[model samples]
Target: MDQDLNVVRGDSPDWRPPNKLLGQYLLSRLKLHGDRIIQAYPQYNETVTAAVVAERAVRYAATLQSLGVGCGDRVVVCCGIHPHYSSLLLGTICCGAACATLNNKFDSGDLRRLMEIIQPKVVFSMSDAVPQLQPALSQLATIPKLIVLDDEDTWKWFINNKIAYHEPQGIDPYTNVAAIMCSSGTSGLPKAVQITQANLFTSLMAFKHKDAYVQADDIVVITSPLFWVTALLYSLASMDHGVLLVLEFGASEEHVLGVIQQQKATVLFTASNFALSIAKQPSLNSYDFSRLRIVIATGTAMAMDTQILVENFFGASVVQLYGMTEILIATGMTRKGQRILGSVGLLVPTMKLKIVDPNTGISQGCGKVGELLFKGPQVSPGYLNNPEATAATFDAEGWVHSGDIGYADSDGNIFVTGRIKDIMKYRGHHVSPIELESILLSHPEVLEAAVIGVPHPTDVEHPRAYVVLKPGASVTADSLAELVASQVAEHKWLHGGVCFVNSLPKSPTGKIIRSELRYLTES
Candidate 1:
């Protein structure tokens, strides 16, 4: 062995080896604890062992290979709240194929549009989602090979009849594509982000070694759907570390608390909205959350007050992570450092982050807000088949122009201000809707809030606020408007007035649909 290898294998204080392939690493953990419970789906009462999961994944890979899915072929997997979805993802990765996970909640028209855009070679849909998928499938020019999951009757027949058995071929980790995740595409059409095996492995390595929030003995509760990037990474990390994954379908406070209490989950990865909901639960104190160590909030920013309440309730700091489908989880605040509120912490060890002026493309100094750019192994190579959009987003030097606008402090902590495109220009002054929305959410009577910019008859453009009040907590529009005016500058003040609504429209991932809000205002 080489001297470096010898040091890594040896018990040295400063020697540490890097993690390589995710599948091999996870499989080795399965070999150690073959019988231990790895995945639990409460709705179905299905508990899967690490060994069973690996075997099923291998078999599924064989099935995909028979259908002509090989390296670089895109296989779109539309998943619901099924335990088998994770297995399907693993199987696709093992076969060296990229799995594009579609949101199950999309209507037929939207689904068809995405299918036409991606042009996947194969698709895997649950038996329950078939009714909704049929119309979309009919519209595709070249229909993908359909694989039905959770149909025991048909699956049993295939297994019993001695179908063709094939072995899973090992793949080169450095060059193979692993998965494709769609961005929300709030500005325009959703884009398919092609995440390679190296990208996935790099993010997992950072989470394991550099982040050090997750451990092999930790029990992780997965409250978000596997279709999303954050939830998928949590499961992959847990499996890679030989930890237990307790998954719940919905984000209901009651269901989440029950699973956490029953499983004694030590870690949780969820959206900020879900965490806020859990914090606001009337009976939150009833659950024993002392066993919890880490609470990771992504998808949206957590309110400062809500974060404090949740930390006090669980005795754990709520770590805020900044990530997207393009780069997975890039920046995260540690529990110990979370005391510095409103910051997303430093960039990951292997990653490089920069804030550049959107128009000039010049790097900005500390505290100067600009578009965030990232370059690293965790960043996706490009959008699949959309070279125009890919080239536009990724520069010649390989930096990903993340539409998000933020400034890094002198200490290297990143604070995401808002999306550059989402910034409302009122009388030539730029205003971030996130800033306005955050102040609105700070109001004790407001449960949720969203802000949008609409074309104004007199001012060219103006800000509007939509709020969902706390149950039974009454507040009039004038009062709400005054509250916002008191917090913001003259140009940043709401010109369109406050509007009370039962609920604001949200994307499948729980982000407020600002375009829809503008549409509502225009109508």
Candidate 2:
């Protein structure tokens, strides 16, 4: 490891804070103040403290063990925006079993497909989601056990009569799978990504060194759902850091600002869109954000203009992070490093990053745009049960192909251009959609935009744009086309014209589904 990136182990005589495994570190916090409120949900007026969370975790683990969930067993956790869901994930980790967090928005078809692929032994789903999953219940023949998160009466009966609550037994963290989160499925179907205990612990350690913003006294607000890796990892990192977590079921600008003021939140983890929404809120200026120290924006790329707005509004720089479900988070731009407009900052302490040519597979020098590759303890072992996809993603040397096109500057700052598969080929010339999208988004009227390649009758391909205009703003297709033509080269211009849409289709993680856009055009 580089001298600057060296971390102190827990056993070392000179060891500092944040050295233990994520589970153990969380347990220590729980032991310290079991009654101190850890998470609060305003919509339902629900709250959980360290002591209550610990007891529930222990009871849930005992319930899982009694239901035949042992070490190595896969437990599918379909959680919504609730603190209990997070507690259950921690409980599953303590029981030495893998927990797969399924997206609650997935309908019956999506659930059935994932169920067939993962073949989980047991499923823990919220009551609201259980109704949607009812159609696929028969398809999940492999899942012999099911635990509904709602039905308080049932949960009470289980705790009171079904089985006696017992403390979680000792677990070997190194050999267990802490959590399993799926890829965004932007280009294709989603793949299950196995996040082991080591992966979670390593990621938390890296977050401490790379972000290093969370503190014990900080109140961290989490608005993203627990199904995504960013939210799950943030929760774990906060727990490990012994910080108070304020969980929100959904993003409500009013509710968020209220919680920040009432709870005195010091840190926040959310998407760039959500951050932009918060910044755009006129009411935000009235509230005092003096306690807010750090705000992490992930799931989508952060535009420079949006970053500036957030910094100016909150008096805190937005920490931009580039990550995926497959590798968790490998690169992040600290609040201090946001001076470089589009850079994603340096690689994490325990991670290694490289940009390689797509055709040659050879490492590219700085400033050369190519496919980004990463290798670290936080990298997933492989896709669950998809050997072909796993083999295709991981090289012989264990580097995970990120499929993202980016370049590093001389100062070691990383800049993501676009996805390898999303790049457009116009008459044999390669074009990055992100470059076009960024230029279009710079327009005062254009709120969000996506660029896709459409088949041309004469040449290789042509650029097409699907744009969502800012509220109350009016712009014709000709004006939008003229806007791009004036800024970009003739070859890079949108020859296929702009298509107006009410809203662009996006994945659950907030990435634009360009493939779907192309499909819509062709159909």
Model 2 misplaced regions, further than 4 Å: 1-22, 159-172, 184-187, 252-255, 277-290, 313-315, 333-339
* Residue pair clashes in candidate 2: 34-51
lDDT of 1 by residue, 157-257 (tens): 32234234353456666667788787743246777878888788777766555345667788888777767887778767656667788877565677788
Candidate 1: 10-residue stretch with minimal lDDT? 4-13
Question: Could you tell me every candidate's TM-score relative to the true structure?
Answer: 0.89, 0.89
Full-model lDDT for every candidate: 0.74, 0.73
TM-score of 2: 0.89
Please provide, for model 2 over 25-99, each residue's C-alpha lDDT reduced to its tens digit, 9 standing for 90 to 100. 777878787577767777668877778777777677777778777777778878677667767777777677888
How good is model 1 by TM-score?
0.89
